[model samples]
Target: MAKHLDLEEQEQLDEIKHFWKQYGNAITWVLIAVLGAYAAWNGYQYWQRSQASQAAAMYDEVEKVSREGDADKLQRAFDDMKSRFASTAYAPQAGLLVAKTLYESGKVDGAKAALTWVAEKSADAGYASVGRLRLAGLLMDSKAYDEALKVLDTGMTEEFAALQADRRGDILLAQGKKPEAKEQYLKAFKAFDDRTDYRRLVMVKLNSLGVDPLADAAAPVAADKGAASK
Candidate 1:
């Protein structure tokens, strides 16, 4: 029984050796490929983390300069960040801050330039939309009616549609396009929930233009109030 067990063990050992000899290179290559991929992924994650940390530090400087209302310093720092870290979200965020500071400081041209960069270069749709909205406001204030309309022509997101419509109405009103303005106001009013007081403001604007949406609904109530007063 001992001899039989020894022969069986020897056969198993030989079988394992033959298997390794046949598949050794393939097994080694497969392991190397898997390990190589894992190492590359780890390196990529580390690089991304390092870049984000550096960009965040620069963003702090940009925010500080903006809060201090130093337009020149803020512009310089913003240029540095955009040149070195334009792909980061912080770059566009810094641009927005710089634009706001410039706008508040009565630097309309500088503010427009910063906002244009954000509108053109920002990878985030939300940031781009914000830049466009603000730029449109500045253009509207300057009576660049057509340019303001173009800025708002980007087709706003659902969250911004009502505000965009309101702004568009203002621009049209400035251009003396009263009918277009009224239509935009009606769209804005319908876009908002009935419970929102903002909707009431839009309705009032429409009413001022001789298009009273609530008039039919309020007619009976107005009559009742009149009867009570009488």
Candidate 2:
């Protein structure tokens, strides 16, 4: 019986050795692949955090130079931020700050350049819309009416719809396109909420164009009702 038990133990040992010989390399490779992936993910997360930290530091420098009203320093700092961290939110925010400072310092061309960069390259859609709107205003001021219209033609987020329409109306009026201006103003009027002071301003613009927005709306409904009765 003892000899039989020894033979049984040796058989089990032989089976274990056979299993390891068949699958050992594949199991080892699977473990290594999983660990390597985990390590790579951790490395990527660390790199992203490091990038954000560095970008935040540079953005602080931009805000400081802007507040000092130093155009050259502001420009240099903004250039550095854009070069190194354009993917970060802080880069576009710095662009806006630098543009404002440049404009205040009588650097119209510099301001426009910075605004154009933001409009063209910002990662955030909202920032891009703001950049386009401000750049359009500057273009209008320069009497680049066609260029301004082209900038406004770039689509904006829903929140800026009313403001963009109003801006378009202003440009059309400048171009002496009174009928088109009134049409855009009406669109602005409808887009704005009733409680907003901006809506009242839009009404004033409509009135200037000899169209009362409220009356125009009612006239359409009245015409529809009359047609139905007939």
How far does residue 212 in candidate 2 sit from its true spot (Å)?
1.5
Question: Across residues 1-230, which tens digit of lDDT does each residue of candidate 2 receive?
Answer: 99999999999999989998999899999999999999999999999899999999999999888888888888999999999999988888888888888988899999999999989999988998899889998889899999999998875788899989999998999999999998889999999999999899999988877888898789989999999999
Off by over 4 Å in 2: 1-27, 223-230
Query: In terms of TM-score, how similar is model 2 to the real structure?
Result: 0.85
Error of 1 at 49 (Å): 3.3
Tell me the spans in candidate 1 whose CA falls farther than 4 Å from its real position.
1-3, 21-23, 195-197, 216-230
Candidate number of the best lDDT: 2
Report how far residue 120 has shifted in candidate 1, in Å. Answer: 1.9
Model 2: lowest-lDDT 10 consecutive positions: 151-160
**Predicted candidate 1: what Cα RMSD to the true structure?**
5.2
Scored by Cα lDDT, where does model 1 land?
A: 0.88
